[model samples]
Target: MRLNRRLFLGNGAAAATTLAAPALLAEGGGKPRVIVIGGGAGGATAARYIAKDSKGAIDVTLIEPSRAYYTCFFSNLYIGGFREMDDLGHTYGALAANHGINVVHDWAIGVDRDAKAVSLADGASLSYDKLILSPGIDFVDGAVEGWSLSAQNAMPHAFKGGSQTELLKAQIASMPEGGIFAMVAPPNPFRCPPGPYERISMVAHSLKQTNPTAKIIVADPKAKFSKMALFQEGWLEHYPGMIDWIGEDFGGANVSVDPDAMTITIDGETTKVNVCNVIPAQKAGHIAEMAGVTGGNWAPINAEDMSSKADPDIHVLGDAADQGDMPKSGFAANSQAKVCANAVRGALTGSRVFPPKFTNTCWSLIDTDDGVKVGATYEVRDGRIAKVDGFISAPGESADLRRATFEESEGWYAGIVADMFS
Candidate 1:
């Protein structure tokens, strides 16, 4: 029953079943309880694996406010008209009915570490042997001047990828034929580093077809960005003379917006725009802060187990955890969730705990059938998740290769969501 990193990496599903069957596979005599907060990729995957693998021996409860969860991943594609809203939404019915999970639609207001209990907004409490928090990201208040949650409708961040995404798409579609679309990109260490730029690509794609005369401008605070050369090349090739990207060196660092005026000022130069998308700086979701697990803006965790450094009984996942080398993407989150699920099940059931191994790949669509990706495999080293090997799409890949890559991403989206929700 001794499990190692290779077993976890090469045969994860089989390894998880083996570890979970040792002490927990049958119901009846006072089972171990696990409560998971949030229902995103990380939370859903962890909850499902732990519950399904352990059979009825683990009483699993998933506390999520939304009944239908829409993914933030590939949300840019929705703006690009590659996907529909209904196509991105998922339900908790399967986790409840098929997997025997207690899916509660409620807010987790507080976590009492010493008591090992979570207080819900509905005036009820649930105690647990282990608590999993995958609360996602929340914007830092006043991170972007003149833009707050109140102004989200006027200038959508669309980072959450639900109604906000839909609103942004509608706004872009409704712009005047020759209108100017401006974006205020977030600073570094935000959720999905390449997100805003990919969004810009999608917006440009839609406008290029319908309103060929329209323009796009980005005011970014970072001097450089993820996949900068690749995205720049794509912009030049697919939508030439359509996008203007201003980096920090070119006064992109100095930016502010007036939602009411539909304007953005960069380095004392103000320009009026017909549509604005302002994505602000971010931090871990507030519930993690409430749980006292956050260090600065994110929660710290043990790379071996994804357990909160602040509390052994609590684990943090996804964008909320400050695990080095892993980007805050849904793919990374799902990968970490599987590793965490294995460790948690092992700890609870006296099963063999495996050395943690993880992987993530982030894909972006430049245009129709044009795709690019960057990815890496990781292992625990020096008490942090360190990248072992990596690869990225080159600047001048063939059209057929790029199209094949895009097809690969589409298949991945279908696979990961099914791995998480179904």
Candidate 2:
């Protein structure tokens, strides 16, 4: 039988699959069990794909805390008022009913690797033949001075894309007219490299429409950012004299915030702000650490199949996995999940396992109908996922092209979310 995988990727890109193994019974006198932690793009895709492709040969369970997951990908558009929060929200009800997968809405607190089991916050344990960890990202403690989980309400990071996104939007809307909005950008190697800049553009968009004279200051540790020229050009053309981006060369590297006092200090020079957005340094989610699969901040994975380097039975995907050359993106996570799903299913069902091919595209909307993107195809080589070929939107593109790009992004969002939940 032939399955055209292009349906999963919005762009009709096909990935061929082959199966090799004979079907096997469950882990213990039943269907083999696969426990997936995190119900976001990676984990959800893995669980659904495994269960769907296994055809009753394997049992899949997903553990996630949030009943409704808000995607981080196009969240900036929501902030810009291009979309509502509900537009980005997804649920696992489809996974439960349509796919016949077990969806557990709980926190996975521990992983007993030796016992091949996961412990839940509710004091229940689940045994699995294979485990998938895609717990996303967590902030590095003390990475930003004067910023902690306690200060999140005051300076919403809005990076995780749920209530935080709403909080940040409300804060922006409530900013005093002509007020100063400051952002402390995270360091390199963080999730969604272009996210902060896109957010700045979106915030500027909102501010321009409402508080026209409001100013924005971005204190960034990196001297340059993803699609720098493109974003800079767009900012200049769309919102001139409204943004002041301070790179590390200008002391943006040394920064601190006073949440209580509503002040930000860069290079010992403190300035009060109407609203502050602090994006701290990030690492693999805590569950990856609890699973004892993390190396420093991220869980190392074998690029060939997204399996944890520390434990072959455990696979890591998304922001948590340190797979070389693949950005920590929802699209990349979904791509990795497909490859991982194939491998896991192959091992359990003796299905034909084809070589893995991955693709990713990250699109950022600068303003209404103005978008830019970067994308690439990847392959595993020499123990790392390396870029094979790539393309990017250039700085000076026509309005029609930019509009088409944005439209393409809209279609991709619809496609990816459906690929995950529906």
- The model with the greatest lDDT is 2
Q: Tell me model 1's lDDT, rounded to 2 decimals.
A: 0.88
- Kindly give the stretch of ten consecutive residues in candidate 2 with the minimal lDDT sum: 1-10
The 0-to-1 C-alpha lDDT of every candidate, in the order given, reads 0.88, 0.91
The pairs that clash in candidate 1 are none
TM-score of candidate 2 relative to the true fold: 0.97
Clashes of each: 0, 11
Runs with alpha carbons beyond 4 Å of true place in candidate 1: 1-11, 20-29
- Cα lDDT tens digits for candidate 1, 50-168: 88877766789999999899999889999999999998999999998878999999999999998889999999999898899999999999988889999999999999969999999
Which regions in candidate 2 have their CA more than 4 angstroms from the true location? 1-21
Per-candidate Cα RMSD to the true structure, in Å, reads: 3.9, 2.7
Give a tens-digit lDDT track for model 2, residues 138-186.
9999999999999999999999989999999999999999999999999
